[model samples]
Target: MARYARSERESLADLLLALGPDAPTIDEGWVARDLAAHLVIRDRRPDAGAGVILPPLRDYGERIRLAATRRPYPELVDQVRRPPWWSPVSNRLVDELTNTMEFYIHHEDLRRAQPDWQPRQLPAELQAALWRQVGPLARMSLRRVPGRLLVQSPGYGEFSAGSRGEVARLVGAPGELALFLFGRQRVARVQLVGSPALAERLRTARLGF
Candidate 1:
């Protein structure tokens, strides 16, 4: 099987190098170098990666990630491209399962941020893989949201998310839906359908980890 995770990681690394360290990304204040450092730290430094999900470790993780940015930009991109074999998340056995959507989303974080950038025509298999991730992502990110959310990717599938309330629907491709749920609502190409008030709220709600 093709390794989408590996492909996305390589592509992201290439873009980082091509754009140099100063290019902007969809990730708010982060530039290419910062995004590269984040990937390196998340993949290679388990102690700091914990901060991604653990509240108390967040400060420590940010410090480590920020420190990583001072390294040569190419070196940081290389670390992202070729993660250490011993790294927990990127180890051979689990890298596919853990990084497919992670790398894809971050890749787009860089790609979509550039002016005149357009979406890639992804392979159908890759789209299927991304679709599978939507459920868990929505469940996690929308748990606290105040209305019923119906997420639809025509030709793939659809599912309801969020806590119970009036129904609102988000329509987009699998990758776009993933981006929306990951807090890139401003950049994600999704259409909202429902009451104007509820739709606006969902669009602006804090999402992702």
Candidate 2:
């Protein structure tokens, strides 16, 4: 995890760069713009004429992204060691960990938008960084497969086999779930086995912006 403030803007930026210019273009835009704007919201960057704005996702992601961008990583760590941005008001380590998770989670999200997308396992170092989120993402990734809730991923396994209560399926590689939750995507492309209400709820979970 980070010892600095806010989310991982560098990592998010790196991921957008990795997505390349040829990636899928959503009705809103390509994954690149979506990813960038999402992080921008987390950082609370002044909305200086960036065309269309994105919906809100999680504040933590935006915060870290902006914090990371203003200075070099070394400087960021220094900021963490100083005052104003660090205190009981906010534990530096905890904030860094969440920001790390946001980065790791969203990396997968943007990556999954491509037909050729594939996720390397969450890197051990990054995992160590966002280690706390594994359990939480695992639980959140699960969908109630048979109960009118189904999660379908492109190349991954089918979750729940369309039976039983809630299903925590990992159908479309982990990366898909990462981007999906990060709100880089619209749910229309993803089929839901449950009621329209369930789909609506998932759509509106609002991962910040």
Give one clash count per candidate, in the order shown.
0, 24
Highest-scoring model, lDDT = 1
| Stretch of 10 with least lDDT, candidate 1 | 198-207
TM accuracy, model 1: 0.98
Clashes of 1: 0
Q: For residues 1-209, write the lDDT of model 1, one tens digit per residue.
A: 99999999999999999999999998889999999999999998899989989999999999999999999988888889999889899999998889999999999999999999988989999989999998999999998888899999999998998888799999998998999999999988889999999888888888888
Q: TM-score per candidate, in order?
A: 0.98, 0.41
Model 2 over residues 40-96: C-alpha lDDT tens digits?
433333342122244353354445554444444334333332324433333454556
Model 1 clashing residue pairs (backbone): none
